[model samples]
Target: MSETETIYDQIEIEDFTFDPDTQLFTYPCPCGDRFQISIYDLQDGENIAVCPSCSLMCEIIFDEIDLQEYLDQIS
Candidate 1:
């Protein structure tokens, strides 16, 4: 399937919880787990967040500038 077709949903970056220690952004998944993606992966232009307990993935919506600003604050 195409990338757009495979995404379970599109979630805004602000809705996710960021763990500074692991540098991971996460959101609740329907499968009783969290969908996770690394900040480094996002910086590299990867936006898909996957749940470890199931076959669900979501596309993260974010602006590059906002991401950079967040990183700057955390740094």
Candidate 2:
């Protein structure tokens, strides 16, 4: 049987607002619903955006694409 891929493994964002100068990732909004999330400095945990209305979270991996970009591309 094949193993199910995890959310972290499956979801990948493109054209993420990454500042080559600042070396930071930016997510304007990553929620399907009206509730949105904007996360930055994901590795540092200094910036995290969560939507209580839709139970959505911008839990972006530092080296990976921002969740927002993924969501936007799909939707």
TM-score of model number 2: 0.28
Using TM-score as the measure, the top candidate is 1
- Encode model 1's per-residue lDDT on 1-75: one tens digit a residue: 365547789999999999887889999999899999988899999999999999899999998876885686579
lDDT of the structure predicted as candidate 1:
0.89
> Highest lDDT: which candidate?
1
Over 1-75, each residue of candidate 2 has an lDDT whose tens digit, in order, gives: 114422222123343455444444444444443222233344334333344554444433335444454335434
What lDDT score goes with residue 2 in model 1? 62
lDDT of each: 0.89, 0.39
Where's the lowest-lDDT run of ten residues in candidate 1? 1-10
